[model samples]
Target: MSSLFGILSAAGQSLLTFQRGINSTNKNIANVSTEGYNREIPVFQDLPRSGVFMNKIIRVFDQSLFSRSIDLNQKLNSDNEFASGLSNIETIFNDALGTGFSSDLNTFFNSINDMLIKPDDLAARSQFLANAQTLVGKIRNTDKALEDLKQQTVLKVRDQINQINQITSQLAKLNQSIKTKTLDIEVNNEYLNERDRLIKQLSDLIDTKVVFNEDNTVNVFTAKGYGLVVGIESTQLSFETDSNGNAVVKWNNVADITKEIQNGQVGGNLKTIDKVNEQLNKLNDFVTVLTTVFNKVHRQGYGLDGSTNTDFFTIDPSKSGTKIDASNVYINITDPKKVALASDPKYLNSDNTNGKNLLGLKNNISNLYTNPSQPVLTPTEEANLKASLNDPTNYDFIKTHTFAEFYNTKLVAEVSSTSSYIKQQQQNNKYLYDAITEKMKSITGVNMDEELINLTKLQRSYEASARIITVTDELMQTILGLIK
Candidate 1:
């Protein structure tokens, strides 16, 4: 009877262990589709005498693989964000769309050339001013578009910082909870899953490194070594705006981390800000050169009204102290008779010398985007001049140094090259990211088929244990009846 009772006790414990195993397998199946969920596996230990006991629950996780996934996710996210923002900028300068500065610039100069046909025609001069206005409008609109991109970047940075803070806070809380739960040999798999999910999310916003402590708490920090969370204490991140209201990322509410964010969405936005600044500066330089060259020739010429020493383009007073180019360039003259087309006052209304001088700009090239050692005209610009040089008598004296040539060869080409490079980089990252993601899923993702097999195994063990208990009880009863 004593032996039967011992067997019965052992069977009961075995039954309970198998039941726990089944429960764990079921849990895995239930959460198979959950993002960042790891499969749960219940570990069993044999008792000193007999039977088995549930020792702990271990999540199917590969620490190294998971860490690598986080890093790759940061890079992938950064590249994707940059690609989207760059695409927006590329559209603003696309000459194929017919909305580029090149078209407007060509119209403005063509109007000036048209005036040479009817040097004293009010309608021709009026048309010149209209085209000039259109050119100014195009420039201003381009600047506005860039400014809008900057504003959008600021908003995106702010939002990303907010999300980072939120994620860190949650991670800190989960770290505390997981620590407490892990104090026992059997840790709570649910808390661990939640903690890992938050960590992954944080990784997507900014680059991060995670370290797990023996106490089950995790320490999180930026890849640059700034602490984000340590022992349940999370530091908050915020934006540090410049005087111009441009956003800069900060770590722990201090230190400008904008440049340090090398990967993730915040990194992408930071890079976009730099790109915007670069284009803005380039446009400003082009404006300075354009104004300087055009104004120099205009000052030497005589307007229809015998005007001299007047600039054709001037900066707007409202934009004083600003960069004072592109967005602010305005035509200086107000009178129709003030359109200068001649170098001599006696033939001011009939001479086409200044007009032809302006036309020469169409083919003039510089070392804008070429090697400094090679300052010769670009073949593309020369080809453009040749293509438009149908009438040598009408346009032969027309100079080859136009704004269109400089802009197309220098700024447009440079931006298009950048766009192509970024797109290629994005595609490479996408491929690498997809590969890493599959690796991570294979290591941690739940498989319902495997879970079902585990369930069946647990059911068989449970039934065998139940049968043992039943047989032990039956044998004890038979022995009792004999003794009675």
Candidate 2:
């Protein structure tokens, strides 16, 4: 019961609807190689009577796949950052390269052996002081390297926070644009894609959570529930120096979240900073042990000049602090004749008892060099290994395990083990991230051949609908001719 004009109207509307489908197909073909682009499908709904109309779009995406991808990306970044920091620390302790504290320590102790053999040799005493200076330089350099690494990591934390804030701010803008244009399918689709891209980028800097809203807006939060983006407003993260001069991450520039972050670049930086501080603390303890017992013994002995009660180790006068920090402790005796090598005034120049005693201290401190075949510590020994760190004067424990053992087993080995673990974790995370990415691509990636076929079908439909319109117009013309 429809008129000819009604037929023309349906055909005309169908042409536009089919054209929309064609445009979408062409777009899919055009963007086939675009990264992070999710191909879209234009859904057409049948009209109540006899026509079809273009409806909403169904973006090809799986939320679960996207979430997993972000998770793995953040984890991989964390491992990468940790590995980079540890690499620098490993270089500091590379003894095989002849640049570490081991050789200097050996030379210093060998000088003591020379003095014990020839008590009248002032050359032996001078060589000992020279070797001691070299050892002190090595320790100072190691401490400076660790401190530098920590400062660099702290800067990384601050930089990551800034990056996170920038991403969240951009996300907030996208949310506003998306909410305003929710009804505009084309514009909103692009906005959603951009939002997803930004979210993935944010995950690289910090661990975050993304929630999709009913109105197509997204809200972002930290893993610990700190709001980053909500509706159209974004809360930013900031960094400040705490009382200890360590950088602390904060929410709204107030509440500290430095320890709260556990993954991504920020988490890795925080964790590496802790490790640097640990090494510094251990190095300080080692210095305390070196200066404490060496000075105690040297001060009790007598030099050729009958010098008595002369301290062997003191802070560099040029330095401002009194603490015997690793970086500040130096050789205080420059005069070879001032070297204390006698236990008695009766035989000050002839007897080498004090020289022999000093050699004994050196032997115990570097025991691993002379006895490398010592068995791995028992449980009791392992428990006592760290006791010297609290009280470095515990010569009972120090003598057995030796300073060389503590440095190698505890310091060097810790870096090596952590590096190995992180390398493995980085490899595992890459595998998992790749697997998830492949799945996501299969589901959302554009298929050029499929899109071409769809384009052909849409073109044919559009042509047929145009033909109907042409035929109906001719029929109307003929009816007008009859009326004339």
Candidate 3:
């Protein structure tokens, strides 16, 4: 009787095993089309047989294979981040190419050259003034465009930081739930798969490393070495805007955590901001030099009609004192009544024989960007020129020089170089992003056909397992009736 009981118990265990197998296959088939879901397999182990009779079933998952899946997920995430950063930078630089400031600078100086050839013509003077206004407009437009780009970048950074915070919070909650569930091996595997998917998503926003603890909890850290998760809780990151409207990432109100978030989207954004700031500073310096030199020359030169002391171009004193507002700069030649041709024919003379005192100003304009060796005008020379313009000692010496050429050459070169460099960077970054994205797609992208095939396989397995359980139940019923 005991031997018969053992046989019945073994048969019952086999039936239960078949039922569990059927359930697992059905579950896999159901989730085949789900995003971020990995195919699951039920592992069966034989229980210790007594007198050659199998008694129980144990199901397990291959942890090594699961770990490999997690690794692949992380790689895909990093590739996505690199591709996104490159694409964004490309867009910014491409837009910068159409600023049009370089051409305006060239035209402004060309008009001045025309005026020099026909200084006696009032129309030529008027044309020079018109071109000057156009040049000012170009500078203002270019400055504004750069500022806009910078602001947009800041906003994007802020948005990304917010997303990071949200993702981290979700991950923490998921971790807690996973720990509390105390699920079977199959269910635990599912939890791990979900956790890895979330980690991959977080990786794209910022570079991170995931550490799986023995307790089935995961700890996350930035690639640059800042703790993002501890046990089942996650740290929060946020962005703060400074007075200049620049966005900065912070943790617990402590600024300067940017370095901790390296090799991810956040890192890419920070690098872009640094590059933009450098470019902005260089542009500001160029504008300051252009305005200061032009104003000095304009203050020295008398109008073509030899009017009393007045600056040919009006410069904003506010700009000269501190921050240079390229937008606010304007040509001060408001008095159309004061406009006149150079009074003396000798004004074109290089020597004192010419009434004009314009010396070296024309050469200065033409050589501004071309000749790096050109000496900057000294304070003493500037003061002397101012005094000479007030006293009118030698108009002949001034005739050879003018304000138009000097300002135009430097402005044109700076604008052209800046625009060109930005465009080139944009294109190069775009290519890199495309390449990385293609590689990532090959690795992480889902194949619907493959998934469908898997679904069919699971469906067949489930049916076969169900049939085994049904046969086992029929056998048990027959044996019970025969025993009765």
Candidate 4:
């Protein structure tokens, strides 16, 4: 009877252990579609001279794989953000769909070429003035678009920082709750899953470095070593507007971290804004050269009204400080008769010398993209241009490249090339991110078929343990009956 009782006790413990195994398998199958969930496994230990019993449940996770996935996640977000912002800027300059600055520039100059046929034709002069206004409108509109884009990008960063704060706050709370996880009877999986999910969410907004703690909580920091979370507490990031009305990212509302954010969405946006400002400066330079050359040549010619030395293009240099830019550059001449067509006032309507010489200027300074260096101006033609080009000190770029070619070669080409490179990197990192995630999933994600098989085995083992307990009870009853 004593032996039967011992057998019964061991069989009962075995039954409980098999039941625990089935519970773990079921838990995995139930959470198969859950994001950030790890499959749980039942660990059993055999007692001395007794049956096996489950000790605890452990989640299937690989530390190395998890850490690598976080890194790829931030990098992929950085490139994706850059690509998105760059597309907006590219669209502003791209004229494939409509007439942008480049197109208007060609039309403005081509209109001048048309006027050469009949210098005194008021209809031709009127069309030339109209084209000039269109060209100026394009430059001003482009400047406004670039300004709007930068402001919009700054707003976007502000929103992302707010999102980062929300994630950090949740992460701190998860840390406190998950401290009791993975150790005792409270083997809570949701706390750990939510913690990891928050970490990935934070990574998308900015670069993060995660440190796993022994208590099943995590400590996170920026790649630049700014701490975001310590133990169960999280730090909040904020921003301030500088005197120039630029957004400056602040850490803990005290220290400026604008330069420290070298990855993720915030970093991408900052870089994009920097590029916009750089192009803006280059545009200003191109405008200075353009206004100088066009105004000077126009002043040297005479209009139908015998107007000379009048600026064809004007800019408020006082507001612009050092030089004219797209912001202030505009047509000074509204009257079609003010369109200077004669190089000399004496040859106003018949000679066409002044207008012809103006046409020679465009040909001399050939558009790098459209044509190569034109044959050098004849000595007589060079003499005629010298009257207007006397101030060689003012025009530097126009000596070699046309207005359109200068902007296209310097500014547009740079943006396009940089954008293409970033897009490629974004694509490549996406593939890498997916690969790392899949690898991590292989170890941590539940396999439906595998779980079902394990469930079946657990069921069989549970039944066998029940049968043993029954048999031991029956044997004990027989012995008891004999003794009685």
TM-score (all chains, Cα) for each model: 0.88, 0.89, 0.69, 0.86
Q: On residues 1-484, what C-alpha lDDT tens digit does candidate 1 reach at each position?
A: 6778788999999999899899788877888888888887789999965799998888787887878788888888888887787777788888788557898888887787789897889898898888888888888888888889989898999999999999988888888787777544335677887888888888788988899887657899988888899888999987778986678777766787777887888888888887887777666656655665566557767888888878889988777743237778888887878877776688876886766665544455343211335433345644543443323221222234456655775557777787788788888878877888788787788877788888999999999999999988889889989999
**Would you list the rank order by lDDT, best first?**
2, 4, 1, 3
lDDT of 4: 0.78
Model 1 residue runs over 4 Å out of place are 182-187, 365-402, 478-484
Clashes of 3: 14
Per residue, candidate 2 scores C-alpha lDDT tens digits across 1-484 of: 2588788888888999999899888888888998888999989988864477998778887988998999999898888888888888888889997546876777787888888777778888788888888899999998888888888888888888888989999999999898888566877788888988999999888888888898878899888999999999999898987664577988997778888887888888887887787778777777766676577667767888888788788998888664677868878888888788887877778777666656666646432222345322334643454464644443344556777776786678888999999889899998999999999988999988889888999999999999999999999999989999
Better of 2 and 4 by lDDT: 2
- Scored against the true structure, residue 116 in model 2 reaches a CA lDDT of 77
- Residues 395-466, candidate 3, lDDT per residue (tens digit)? 222223433332333334434454465456546545655565444433433345654665565456545545
> How big is the positional error of residue 28 in model 2, measured in Å on the Cα after superposition?
2.2
Regions more than 4 Å wrong, model 3: 1-9, 30-33, 48-98, 308-325, 336-376, 379-484
State which candidate, 2 or 4, has the greater TM-score: 2
Cα lDDT tens digits, model 4, 248-267, are 99888888989888678888
**TM-score of candidate 1 to 2 decimals:** 0.88
Score residue 251 of candidate 4 by CA lDDT: 86
Q: lDDT (0-100) at residue 241 of candidate 4?
A: 66
**Model 1 score (lDDT):** 0.77
